[model samples]
Target: MDDLSRDIIRQKYPEFKEIPSQIANGTKYMPYFKDCNGVIDDTLIDVIIHKENQLCYKGRKETPTIDVLQAYNFDLLFTYVLSGWEELAHDSHIFLNTIGNPSINFPKPPPGKYYLVDKGYLERKSYLTRYHKIRYHPSEFCGANPRGQ
Candidate 1:
């Protein structure tokens, strides 16, 4: 499915081929969600491919094998940018990282609206509260919490 999606994107949007990483690693595609006010409403879900190799030797013969893992990476910035929601005032907590260093941060979106996200996006609350006119934090944590304390 991941490969099929990549092929479809490449066929539909030739410009994607220009992206260096896309050309090399066969494009990482993401899906984004936005609110009525044009603020980003969810993390961008991306499909990433992991490659590995295996080596085998039989007497005087040698062979190599390859493997792939269909993994996902969620990037906050990719959500807003891909959704064409830049019309917002750029003051909302529009971006979030769902893994590794779980964090969320972005400039205020607009005077009357803000982005909504989960608690995993805790890194930027201070700024969101101060500048964003309104922000919604979901009660659940949707990503890993490194500080398990």
Candidate 2:
């Protein structure tokens, strides 16, 4: 099933061949993210495991789950996916492990480019994360601009 889904997505959307038009030209996502290639994140998907092995997969969620790491472009097409991690694993740990292991061949951002990540991951050379305690989502900017910290 995984192979089928991946094949279908690959055949339908095709991999991002170059910098997205929005970022390439001075359009909507320019200035702030002109050098951004894409986004990377991880999610926990509920899964059924044998009773004996359930303990290792149990985490915050009531049911067992597997952490799936995915990287996608601004067009919302998945460029890469690494799944089957136990739910108990931390997102940072999984991210580091994936990049450290040469066999995986993770899609690293080009020099001077980066991937926008959420608070779950740390800020690094090619990965940019929000400042701690700062409001990021637009919804938080209600009515007028934010006041002094």
Candidate 3:
């Protein structure tokens, strides 16, 4: 990357140990050894991309926003991030545009490893996203569940 890009990235990400992945607590503390799960999600920062193009969702009026797609571990360390996406863009679209490549850009998991994600992502080999027809909330799971929720 050029100096400007490097500077931007430096500002966006913290100084971190360069590794593929690491298991939280294990003897084999090597790169690509970490678990990728639940920690992947996107949040909108206050900065707006569009001023007049506001949206109304549910019951609230939503303003234009800049979305930050972040991935963290159990320790809350950011492993991956993608910024500058418009608020109206879909999460799956962002993932596809950035990650759907013959030469994958994101960190690769081990043979049997996969990530835990929400329903926004497509059902893929390396991601374990939430199912479409399941109730994951505690209230929905109050009664006896034969599926062992």
Candidate 4:
């Protein structure tokens, strides 16, 4: 995170480590999320690009758009944002590029802390994602008894 962003988090959420009682008591996920600082995801935003550059921006979706990477804390406050990546760029690719490029100054989690990400992101040391083999979809878990563990 940048200096301004860090200051905002510090000022707004001084007790960042403290999980709210409601969330902690209501969900099993909160216990395992003690070390999670926030969540990260990328989204495609439609845009009207010049015809010359449209081809480069086109991806699986027919619409021309830019993929934007964003990070948000538990409070749903935006902590970081990276924009301008072409739609063709995958989530993992953007994440890797942001962290790998020193110039980008991607906010990295501190030691023992991590950012929760979806399976589209790399399963790296500081990124927490679900195991590929797990039945993660909500629909898959529906039934009288549910299915797998």
Candidate 5:
């Protein structure tokens, strides 16, 4: 949907916009999923907002702004939110903070698979074993130096 339509919907239903949908086969499914083998998975998702503007000077300066929203998902059974921020000229970061929190209440991972993540999700071996969770920072911002370091 376009920005205008999304904004209208969001205004009408603020909480509705934050609810995560399970996407499969080009359809929005319920947040919970169950497989034939009696396995269930709970999806964790987050949203990011980006703003762009056009500057114009017609006797009086004016700036028009547009906002875009992006959603991302990670395996909650093995990850958590570490950090998320907007980059100056690149995609935003959706850092996943890993945790060892027991998965006793959650569905089990597929056989021989502890967890699964897309390429955007970062994984570190040292941290995985020690923390039992994965941390992800968008690749584009990896090389940028810290503000005061």
Candidate 6:
């Protein structure tokens, strides 16, 4: 899906030499990873619950859910996927449970490179996040939004 999305961008704009890490002018220096985020997806409910609070969330309605974390590169190819976590788990908790374990966490990015994450994740030396309350979406200001909503 990420590949398909990137392909469409290249197709529309053939002179795709450089896409800034994050920028209208410039938001990041080179040796940086692209944006990545977590999302909750509805899944078939099991008869039992691991925790009482894992029942359901408003965002996902009454169905059980799983939190999926994915990372992507500048070309929007998926670099990683961390999943199989309960829906009610805090984003930070899910992250901590994954990173410290050798079998799960991958090697750290090279010294200067960092992954852009959502505000839920901590602002560590290895990762960066955008302003919490700011509107970073281009469509917010320009009516030429792609969503067509």
Local distance difference test scores for all models: 0.26, 0.72, 0.54, 0.72, 0.26, 0.47
Better of 2 and 3 by lDDT: 2
* lDDT string, candidate 6, 9-109, tens digits: 12222222334334323333323323222121113233344566555532355555656665554444454556556666677665555555666643344
| Candidate 3 similarity to native, TM-score | 0.58
Clashes of 4: 1
TM of each candidate vs. truth: 0.21, 0.77, 0.58, 0.75, 0.18, 0.55
What's the C-alpha lDDT at position 24 in model 5?
26
Q: For residues 2-111, what per-residue lDDT tens digits would candidate 4 score against the true structure?
A: 22343343324433565534346545556787777778898888989899999978877887988888887766677777788888788899988877877765678767
Give the number of the best model, judged by TM-score. Answer: 2
For candidate 1, write residues 48-112 as lDDT tens digits: 22334222111122332121112121221222222212222121322332112222122333333
TM-score for model 2?
A: 0.77
Order candidates by TM-score, high to low.
Answer: 2, 4, 3, 6, 1, 5
Residue pairs in candidate 4 whose N, alpha carbon or C atoms collide under 3 angstroms: 1-107
Residue pairs in candidate 2 whose N, alpha carbon or C atoms collide under 3 angstroms: none
Candidate 3, residue 74: how far the Cα is off, in Å: 1.4
User: What 10-residue stretch in candidate 1 is worst by lDDT?
Assistant: 29-38
Per-residue C-alpha lDDT of model 3 across residues 28-143, encoded as one tens digit per residue: 44334454442567777655434354452111235556667666654555566667666677889877765565342455445566666657877678777776787668875468
Q: For candidate 6, what is the TM-score? A: 0.55
Candidate 4 residues lying further than 4 Å off, grouped into runs, are 1-27, 139-149
Candidate 1 wrong stretches, greater than 4 Å: 1-50, 53-108, 123-149
lDDT of 3: 0.54
